[model samples]
Target: MFKNIYFVCFILILSSCGKDPLPKPSGELRLEYPAHKYQSFNSDCAYSFDYSTFAEMQNAKQSCWFYINYPKMKAKIFLTYFPIHNDFALHVKEAEKLVYEHTIKASSIDTKSFSYPEKKVYGNFYELQGPTASNVQFYVTDSTKHFVTANLYFNSRPKPDSLAPAVEYIKKDMLHLIDTFKWK
Candidate 1:
């Protein structure tokens, strides 16, 4: 009886080890964002631009500051408008400083400048990579009278991989905003 029991146990163990366990097929979460369609954002403030129809704009304390909320993605792009007021250098410096502040955790920061001399719109667009708090920052100015800065933030934990799709979608929206931007 003991020999029969041992033989049965051995067979069971051998059967369980038959094939090599395959590693879980390495995979990543696939996320899809909405296709962007934009509309004009006209305000009583110093500047105006085109924003994604997907986002909802909310008023802030000051007339010149507003939030472009992406409720679905749990993110918002904060826009602040400042009058140049013979202090253009100070405004530009502050914008650069704000971008550099994320350097501690940023893997890389890429800046691209856009100029529309015909429309008198000029500024710098910054894309900050890594686990930084703000993934994108930009400042557009008419150089003498208007300086508008925008930055993006997510409501949840800053996971670069998880937020990549949302960031890319918003980035395109922002670029379109810059291209159509004009002083009001």
Candidate 2:
């Protein structure tokens, strides 16, 4: 009886040994985003542009300052409009200052300048890479009468790895706005 029991145990162990157990391959988080679309946004303010229809526009504390909220992604693009009256330099300086302030946490920053001379639109767009409060910033202006500065922020703490997708999606939207931007 003891021999029979030992033989059965041996067979069971052997049967389980056909394949080496592979450590299950590490898993990566998969995120899916919807196809983006935009609509024209124009007001009596100094600026007009196309904005993502996916985001809801909310009035901010100031009249011309408002937020484009992405509720699904828990992000917001805060936009401020300033009517330049010989203070264009001041606004530009402040925008650059705000972008530089994130240097402490930003591993790197890349900038791309855009201009539509026909539209009198020109500005620098900054993409901040790292775990920072604001990962994107830009100031658009006609260089004379209208200056608009925008910042992208997530409601939660910045996690570059997890937030990469959202950042990219919103970045495209920002670019669209810049492309279609004009002053009335």
Which candidate leads in TM-score?
Answer: 1
lDDT of 1 at 92: 97
Model 1: pairs clashing at backbone N, Cα or C within 3 Å: none
Instruction: Show how many residue pairs clash in every candidate, following the order shown.
Output: 0, 0
* Backbone clashes counted, model 2: 0
- Candidate 1 Cα RMSD after full superposition onto the native fold (Å): 3.8
lDDT of candidates 1 onward, in order: 0.92, 0.92
Segments of candidate 2 deviating more than 4 angstroms: 1-29
Candidate 2 residue-wise lDDT, 1-184, digit = tens: 9999999999999898877677987655777778889998877787888999889998999888989999988999999988889988999999999999999999999999998999999999999999999988999999988899999999998889889989999999999999999888
Q: Write the per-residue lDDT of candidate 1 for residues 30-82, one digit (tens) a residue.
A: 86877889999887787888999999999988878999999988999999988
